[model samples]
Target: MVYLDNNATTRLDDAVLQAMLPFLKDEYGNASSTQHRMGRKANEAIQKARIQIAQSLSASDPSEIFFTSGATEAINWALKGVAERYTSLGNHIITSQTEHPAVLQTCAQLQKRGFEITYLPVGRDGLINLEDLKSSIAEKTILVCLMAANNETGVINPIADVANICQERNVLFLCDATQYIGKTDTVNLQNIPIDLLCVSAHKFHGPKGIGALYIRRKRQPIQLETMIAGGQQEKGFRGGTYSVHNIVGMGEAIAHSAETDWRSIANKRDYLEQELAEKLKHVAINGEQHDRLCNTSSITIKHVLSSELMSQIPDIAISSGSACATGTRDPSHVLLAMGLSPDDAKCTIRISLSKYTTDGEIEQTIEAIVAAVHKIRSNSPTWMLFEKGLLD
Candidate 1:
């Protein structure tokens, strides 16, 4: 099968698997244990992984990085922990409508606790207006949550600008960089005024069920109320036994990403887009005018249902929307937020490539998409009307 859904999750790199295998077998020990050699070894390995992740992000210190189950858990902890800790300072938060459900749902939970959330709207290109964000920041606003790159559309947000705005307002900035971390250079984040950042291992070819949150340890030290209380793992912020294998895998995967030729991946993505445009008519590339990720292409076929098209091309692994929302039949909230009608949103599919994706795979995917879309559009009543010049 031609796998074109790297945005959802990437295959584990061989090096990463090799690094993790030892910890999963003979070297297994609790990171919290420090009395014995085995426990000390595990603890040292966890610290090394933390340092590796910190170095990858160019963070100031390894102490600032905390491991979590994944991006979802990190996001929830960041949002809820900050909300509870800073309630006396402010009860209002700002975010965009195109955020992952982790952020949106956490904001919803905060709303129940009487914290007001202002969800800024996005344009047709899936980018937030800085002016709208600036205007929304009231005296009660304590935090601004935004993503570095959109998962579905892959549209890169103006995070530096947002960070500057937050810094000017003296509010905390939280960036969900799950989609941006390995694909881009975020190592020099010290220059940006972001306080909190989230990244997932699986999104960057690491094992699943492990991620990290970067908490900037400057100025006031970005205080947070503990979410899980038990052990002193992750500086007492998160309480749980460390998943040593996953952590090792995450570090190895990130290290491997540094050697990837991203330009080649971008070339493949561009070639795929060019092929799609050549083969299909009235095909809309969502967020085409914006600065998007090099590996993602969100396309909408004018008269075809995305589900039907995907069904026709079963050999090509693609997604109609996010993997997190797989069972839901609703249209993409990200597309709808970008002014796409429900029908247009339903007709959209997200195709994301990886560094391992080959030219041959891209060619096969394009052929499959073209054939599938043509078959679906031929049976579509809307296409028939448009062909007869009876539909606008």
Candidate 2:
């Protein structure tokens, strides 16, 4: 099977699995219980993983990184933590309409609790206007939540500009870097000044059920209330039995990513897009005019139902949209926010790549997609109507 849905998750790397095997078997120990040798070993592993993740993001120190279940939990921690601590100063938060359900749902919850949320709009290219963000910030605005890369379209946000604007306005900036991690190096704290950033290990070929949140604490230490109330783990921020094996896997994945030639993924992605455009007509790539992640392609084929095309190419693993939002009748909120009609949104399919993706795989997938589009459109009544000038 051709798996082109890396954005949903990646196959666990062999190196990462090997590193985690020892912890999963004989090295089982509670990281918090450092009295015994096994426990001490686990604690050391956790710290080493912390440093690995910290250095990967160019963070100032390892203490700023907090482990969580996944990026969803980290996102909740960041948004709700800021709301709990900074409500006295302000109750407004600014974010984009194209944000993930994690961010959008968390912000919606905040709104129900009396916070004002301004969801900035994106143009057809799926990018938030920096000026709108600047104008949205009020004295009551305490934080601005934006994503580094869109999960659906792969359109990159101007995070540096957003961070600069937030810095000038004295508002905290939280970036959801779930799709951005491992694909690029745009989330460096030293360069972007993002107050909070969240990443999932599984996005980068690590194990699932593990994620990290980087909270800025060096120069401008921001205060946030604890989200998980239980123990002294994560420096009293979260409480739970540490998943030592997963953490170790995450570190190994990060280390492995450094050696990968990601530029090759870009080449394959561009080749796939060019081949599709050449073989198929009435096809448009969303966010093509703007900078996007090198490994993602969101294409809309007019009069083509993504559901039908995907059904035709069952062996090829692609997605009609975000995995989290699929299986529902509603169109993608991200595409709608980017000015796509519901019909166009339904016509769009997301094809994401990874280091494991090959030139042959890309070619086969492109041929499959081109043929499937042709087959789907041949049976589509709407295509016939449009061809006969019976409809627009």
The TM-scores, one per candidate, come to: 0.98, 0.98
Poorly placed runs, candidate 2 (over 4 Å): 218-220
TM-score of 2: 0.98
Residue-level lDDT tens digits of model 2 in 347-386: 9999999999998999899889888888888888999998
Span of 10 residues, lowest total lDDT, candidate 2: 183-192
Please estimate how well model 1 matches the true structure, expressed as its whole-model Cα lDDT.
0.90
lDDT of each: 0.90, 0.91
Q: Taking the tens digit of each residue's C-alpha lDDT, what string does model 1 give over 239-334?
A: 888899999999888877888787888899989998999889988899989888889999988878888888898899999988988889899999
Top candidate by lDDT: 2
